[model samples]
Target: MEIKVSLIISVFNGEKYLRECLDSVIRQTLKEIEVICLNDGSTDKSKEILAEYSKDSRFKIINQENIGLGASRNKGMELAKGEYIAFLDADDWLVDNALETAYNEAKNKNTDITMFQMINYKENTGEEKKNDWFNLDKFDKRFKDTVFNYQQTKEFLFHLSVSACQKIYKRSYLERINAKFPEGIYFEDAPFFFNIWLRANRISIIKEYLYYRRSHENSITAKCDEKFFDVIPSGEEFFKIFVETGNYEIYKEELINFAINAYRLTLNSITEDAVEEFYKRSKRQFKKIVNSPYIEDFKKYMSKGNQDTFNNVLNSKDYEEFKKLNVNSKGNF
Candidate 1:
């Protein structure tokens, strides 16, 4: 059978929902698809679950030591035989027609990337909420049912969702760009997603929520630790990519806004123990932003609240003073 889509899943001790994830792929309407499961040193019943699913011809499992999600995904991409590639977390499941619909849309438009929407599933309350961030029309009406390149949509660059799992890429396009996730990082998706879209000549959108992103305490995003600092390097990598590609001059304001938003999110999520170090790192990053050639543009583009936050970062001598400055303010801005 010809493989139209190769769904790559990196499993690492995801036994709780591994079966459901595998089942969703097995039940995909698109039968001409290959499921690549990278068992990244799963010690639990995950291996047995994968073994059970490996009975199917389309399901191939690669058992290897834990090399982190980014590296495992890179390995899966290297071995993928399908025309297009998609990623799914082992704890997340997909809608039955996800692959089929995305594949049809991608083929029909001859797009380098096909982006879609995702629903967040809360493990505690079983609540499902559609994340509107993926709704292209919300950013601009012209984006609806449109096939366009990065330059055409550059104005809304920062507004776009960076979740790699919410999109599918043409295998040839990925190979041409030598696209690979940043290994040994927690927020690798940001760089990978931005790099692809920036270089993609043609991209399409599927507004349908095709993927279910599980929200649980065990997930990496829920934890507040050193890994949260990974967002800093991830942001730097993408910013550097923009500069190297000569797009920085065109989207400096957007890129700076993206960095500010990322820094704020990190500040809000990180543990108290990480405050001092994170503050230092963020202050360094903000210093670069203020000292850049586009400092005037950054000032004009920044909101009053963000300006205050920026000033606090630059003026505060220590994290203690920084905390005190925003102790009563909402969002710590």
Candidate 2:
């Protein structure tokens, strides 16, 4: 059978759980699919595990030096022959029917992107946090098993976690929009997926949680290094893209909210001495974004909750209060 989907997993010394990850993909019901595993210069037995999986014709292995996650996934996208492409982290696994369920809906609706839900999988206890954005109560009734065009889905895009794994993109659609992850950046998904989401006319959402995002200490988001600040730049790159292309107001509320969140994360993750400088820099950015030519339009279009946040970001006293609220919510950024 011709390959209908190409699932890419980028690895960097992930031998410990690599077998389970590969097994999940190999056992997928979507038979017409290829598992593309990119070995990012692993110093461990990751290469060996990949070699064992290479025995299966459907497994495509690309062993390269550590070029980071963005570059590795970019290579996989360039080499993918399938009509649709999806991502899976080396440390994470699929839900057996993930590709099948996602592909069927995407192909049937001719969607540019099909997004499913992922539960945080706990490695030690094998328990999953089922309370997620995908939970039925959390989603609008109209969004369930539905297809949304660009304008219809614009607001929903902001709620997306920016994780490439929970989404499947049409190969041609990605090429048309030049949707690419920024190499060497820690938060490449913020800019990359936002760009893609803007260009997507048809995006489908599945209520079913078809992916498992493992929660482990080794994950990048779990770390609080200098790299944690990369999300600020990543968000800015796309914020400019929206403004330069005259698409700012169309997603102004989202862009502004994302900026505020980025500012909060930066403040929480940076050293004490760096906080003031970061705050000043972010304040300037906030001003630039909020001083939009369509600020009125943004206010009109923004949801109530967002409007309050937007107002607070612009106000010194209220913004300080907002910071206090987020004081205890550090470390996860």
Whose TM-score is greatest here?
A: 1
Q: Report the lDDT tens digits of candidate 2 across residue range 70-90.
A: 999999999898989999998
Model 1 agreement with the true structure over 1-333: per-residue lDDT tens digits: 889999999999999999999999988999999999999998898999999999998999999999999999999999999999999999999999999999999999999999988888999999996655755444456777889888888766777788999899999999999999999888999999888988998998887889999999999887887787888889889988898788887887778777777777677678888867888988998888778876797788766556667778788899888878867555464
Clashing pairs in 1: none
TM-score of each: 0.91, 0.81
In candidate 1, stretches whose alpha carbon ends up further than 4 angstroms from where it belongs are 137-141, 284-302, 327-332
Consecutive 10-residue window with the lowest summed lDDT within model 1: 131-140
lDDT (C-alpha) at residue 315 in model 1: 85
Give the Cα error of residue 206 in candidate 1, in Å.
1.7
